[model samples]
Target chain A: MSKKSVPVVNIADRLAGFSELWSQKTVAVLNDYEVKLAKLRGEFVWHSHEDTDELFLVLSGRLTIQLRDGDVVLAPGELFVVPRGVEHCPLADEETAILLFEPAGTMNTGDAGGPLTKAAELVS
Target chain B: MSKKSVPVVNIADRLAGFSELWSQKTVAVLNDYEVKLAKLRGEFVWHSHEDTDELFLVLSGRLTIQLRDGDVVLAPGELFVVPRGVEHCPLADEETAILLFEPAGTMNTGDAGGPLTKAAELVS
Candidate 1:
């Protein structure tokens, strides 16, 4: 008999390990869970999901998560969670690398109208 | 009735906003949800919880999360999850600032044996 093993993938290795913008690439998945990477810039459309919260972690640059009320700014090494049903938008002043964690079917821009609605799929 | 306002406390402000290490400080609590900060260095003892996974986000310096079989190294801006019932330890090469998210009653060192068992409490 053999034991199943989980591979150790360095996230920095994976992100710096690739070159892509606004496109998320899967790095690891555990028990139906996944870790993904994305490079973003400029501003994202305002939107909100009806069912799940989304987590955003800044890797290299500043990121701002704007809500209907105000905004939360995340410098490098910071994280913010956009709770479900809350309208929000993500903006990056310049090129930035970020990591996102959510359920498999989560959308990039929730319910607000925008041209950047990304259909769910396993990329990378 | 006056609109009940939710205060916005900058986490970095609350953290660098103070100088303390290994002590979790409450930054914001919403819907029974709280965000805390801890400054850790050296190595932490191995431990695990019977329920609930724990999240670690490094703010400065480098951090490593060790498991029974392997380990995950997190550079600044990286994030990792330690699943329930899994034995693990945290190590920092130098003084590191970290943000943690979990339920109200989650412990610092989990169930493993060592000198760093932190009983659940709100410190901030």
Candidate 2:
């Protein structure tokens, strides 16, 4: 492939560009997967992706992935992948910066569509 | 579906278990992709994945990805994705820890497989 300017995405810089809660901004793309940054401070809608697994990595603060069976809490530098078709609700006590990875076109709301459901936008 | 224990991967915890240079340890899996942690101190062979894009996120220290056109430098909290079929080399001045995300079976050496090529093994 012909080369062009290679850009590096700084997580902190991208996080500084947006402050909306639960809004995800795409920072980069890998193959068919999209790398997203989001800030969450409250509980989000319970949802599940039927076609792809979703990866959540906490960049700052703490995040809790609430499942029907139990809750999996993640601290900074921690990550968890919610399996496909599994229901999960993500919440954060304080404003938490997170990195999400899933296939392109994967909706943030998954199967449960509501007001919180918004398409991820490319930040840069 | 019935649920079991949810495992959260701590990047630092997985990184602490391995010290070999260029050896990548799989920390988690998302869909058919693998998240790997690797410790590197020197230059790596120029290689390119013919079938998948590769993401390199710096966790600690500095990493410089040398491409045919230019080099993309990454610091902690920074990431860059080298497009598929682009020949590049990864190097670090000091011991650097990086998180790599790519297809589950993607090799470290890609099309330039040699002694540096090894199967990524799951840890914990």
| Chain B TM-score for all candidates, comma-separated | 0.83, 0.94
Backbone clash pairs for candidate 2 read none
Model 2 over residues B12-77: C-alpha lDDT tens digits? 888888899998899889989999999999999999999988999999999999998878889999
Looking at the true structure's interface, with contacts defined as alpha carbon pairs within 8 Å between chains A and B, what fraction does model 2 recover?
Answer: 0.70
Determine the iRMS, in angstroms, of model 1.
Answer: 7.2
lDDT of 1 by residue, B25-47 (tens): 76544333455788888888888
Give candidate 1 regions above 4 Å deviation: A1-11, A26-35, A64-66, A69-74, A112-115, A119-124, B1-12, B26-35, B62-66, B69-79, B112-115, B119-124
Q: Candidate 2 residues A29-119, lDDT tens each? A: 9998999999999899999999999999999999989898888889999999999999999989999999999999999999999998899
**Per-residue lDDT of B51 in model 2:** 97
Estimate every model's Cα lDDT from 0 to 1: 0.69, 0.92
Evaluate model 1 with DockQ and give the value: 0.14
Worst 10 residues of 2 chain A by lDDT: A1-10
Candidate of highest DockQ:
2
